[model samples]
Target: MPFPSRPVAKPQLRAHSKYPSIPSPSATYLVPNTSDPVGASLGGVRVVNEGLVGIGRLSGENVDKFGETQGAASGLYITDWAYASGQFSGKFNVLPDRGYGDGSSNYAARLHEVNFTFTPYYGTSVVPQTQVQATYVDSTKFTYQDGATVKFTTGLNPDTVGGVVGARTGSLFGQTVGLATAANGPDGAQESLLSFDAESVHLFPDGSGYVSDEYGTYIARFDATKKITGLTQLPGAAQPNRPANTPNFDSFTAPTTGRRNNQGLEGMSVTPDGARLFALLQSATVQDTNGGQQQTRNHARLFVYDIAGANRENPVAVGEYIVRLPQIDLNSDGSGLDGTAAQSEIIALGPDSFLMLPRDGNGLGKGTTVPILFKSVQLVDFASASNILGQFDNVGQAVSPAGVLTPGVNAAATAEVINMLQQDDLAKFGMNTTIPANSNTLNEKIEGMALVPDLSTEQPNDFFLFVANDNDFQSSDVKMLNAAGQVVSRGDGRLNAGITNDAMYYVWRLTIDAGAKFFRMDVADAP
Candidate 1:
């Protein structure tokens, strides 16, 4: 919700009447369609008439005139603004879960098919940057080559079934066997071990399909040669604790690492058949190494890894699930201690069920706020993770206080005035629903999720989630359900009227290939 001012620039003294002169259009500038580097704009937001404005004028030539009117599908290309801001947020490691478009025509070469963005002071402490589009296709046309294929469905409409699309036929990231992390560290220190913002990708009942990093557990190995192939350890980190192992803690600190793969990891969910993997680390442990000036704020953790063989690399931590927050125990009790709450995102629905979106850090250094959806839903059942089945907080039975109230609101005398103003705002954010203060209205700093299935052939685990409110870009909210997590429906006109809240704004990451639904936005005008 940031771009909207276009009617102020006064000071034209001799400003004649309002009817006559109408000739002032020159402001082109869109040459970069090197003939298909992969493109598609078709046209959406091109509002420009650019007429006159004499007297104390102002027109930095309509700044590239919105890519000269998106003609010829457009694929703008230019490169090296320090290599496009050092591939900010870096992602897009290769997509084509099915619908291979990007045949390119150049409307400013699809702004390098934007893989990620939102940190130009977004929400705070920076951290939201990702971009990957170096362009190289030798062997034949579609070339991200090797065997490239990604297909998953659930965009809905007979669209196959459920979701799980993947493809990476080799060349994982900037070459050298692929996967690369460990950047920034010296002073910005978020510490990246082959970095990963939030990605889940799963299809395991044996057909094999995996991808992790809901909070940087970093596991990757789509296999069949698609490249990504390794990194997934934890059956015992090397098995030492003996006694069958269950109580041993030493490292796993920094940026808070525990729960489902610690360090405030945000959102990720996997389980159509895949053994299980749902990590959402959001905060706390932030050790911030080398520079970003000493750190550690709010500590958050939540892990549940267990992918034993055939490409899970080895992953086997089973369960940790820690996110208690009593406003971080009165801001870390001067001498008593209870501090810890960091999680960027998470979403996994099966073998234990899952859904977390913690990030109410008040926008860290300042600004980005709004995401904080933790209605207490973490169902872990990794065989030995010790069964939790339900954590519950259905967001005060689906919101009330005259705002959104659900559970089929019929107002049994306003249900005790909406349960005493939701227990007086859950005691100003320190008494329940897992605790993590910020005035608590739900929203819980979630970054992305789009599930939708439930085509109702008797409700095969029903769904519809949407989520994504990274603080701006029109805020966000959508929820419909079945399979126990009730609710049934909510906003955006009943969430885009159906096929699941359509799409728009910094979704950062969303997957459902095969059935065709690939996403990764953030391109502030490219041409």
Candidate 2:
């Protein structure tokens, strides 16, 4: 689509630099566990400086009359990278964000543990591999580790589980407990979520790291064995099915209740020194809007936590900032033809600065191009931004239209980093091939991101940017629906009858002034 109106001559403002000296940026690409139907097992696992790990037992779906095959598991994606002293080791880990592989409805929504392995060769390369490994989902079931084993009904508030008989109610659940399966739609046994919508996992050196989820609070810590040893609940964040009349805690609800269903906390990161932890909401909180689909709010929240040797209960939010994500360019009917951009992942670069991946659903552009809409990464800083948490508390803002980011008001500062969808950029990353467009379309949910040192180069600032996508286990034509399960529209035209979104990975050379601070150490020395 050419510019309708004559556009002013634009000049590149970036200061050209010679960095990210890696000849090849990507390696062994993996697929999600297509075996499970309901739950697309833990989609992605990334432990900085540790060996890459991913495993799947997929049952390929008949995607195209010819092209790639699709998986039947919940359409989800998980990605992880392997590093040593902050350098790529030619392997990475991949997983599907699946629930407790229990053959129940929860399979689609309630995922538990994920089994992944180090992929040395994408097609047939065997550099150094982290054989099939597992990460067990921690127990959020209060007293019992297996939390989703109870029976419940559909459409009912999911929080009721905590108050149920034999549950870890009241005192056991921090004086309150919410439901993790509210968005799951119906009743299910063994449907409990270990980490609600586990989005990204950042493991520490000592066989322990934090896993961030879009729901079930914001973040939690898992032991080397995969047991969730600690948890981090975002302010105003809570589960569903709480006792009737109970207050809504998950503040980022879609209906302006707490958090829009499924849009809770999505991104999390820790400093290279492991002294600080960072997390952000995928979008505004429910107190702000009903859902990101409403397209009314773009002011997302970024919270920082202190994790200097602190276990599960130790990491607490020390500061908060606003990240106004890119707004969608909608049609009169509020639909995006090209796509809509939303913040999916973030990585801490330095003190109050970081890089963000705000992508759109339009997929990569044609002729080996960038996504027409949200497909690039942004560099942002919260150092000079004001903490408006008090402002929202003083006034009913950030939830509805009561108050928004007023012009002239200083918030987080952001700048364009890279247009990942560009075919040229793909080549620059050593892919050397354009993302072929067709019935087997590759437009995907760009969800995972990680930065590592480019040890292969001379510049100390040289590093690798790992970007990943979650196919949501989508196989052919998918019906994009609203909260009501009503068929709202169809997805990628390529999926009219195309390929399965093979959980994919792409790496790029990134020259960051401050090299990535990764905890690349043996598990025994994490502390």
Which is the leading candidate under TM-score? 2
lDDT of 1 by residue, 1-527 (tens): 11112232322222223211221111111211011101011111001111111001111111111221111100111111111321223222211111111111111111112233222211212121121122221110011122343211110111111231111111233221111121121122221122232233443323234444322234445443333445452222211111122211211222121222223233445544456566544442222111122122322334566764532665565564433221222222233222233433344444543334332233211223322222211112222222221221111111122222223322100000001112222333222222222222223223444333212112222222333323211112222221122222223221111211111222211111221121111123221
Candidate 1 lDDT (Cα, 0 to 1)? 0.25
Superposing every Cα of model 1 onto the true structure, what RMSD results? Answer: 25.1
Local distance difference test values of all predictions, in order: 0.25, 0.43
Model 2 deviation from native, Cα RMSD in Å: 13.5
Off by over 4 Å in 1: 1-221, 224-301, 304-312, 318-321, 325-445, 448-527
Reference-based TM-score of each model: 0.24, 0.61
User: Can you give the lDDT of residue 460 in candidate 1?
Assistant: 25
**For residues 182-243, what per-residue lDDT tens digits would candidate 2 score against the true structure?**
22222212343332455666765454567665534447566665555556666643233223
TM-score of 1: 0.24
Error of model 1, residue 385, in angstroms: 16
lDDT of 2: 0.43
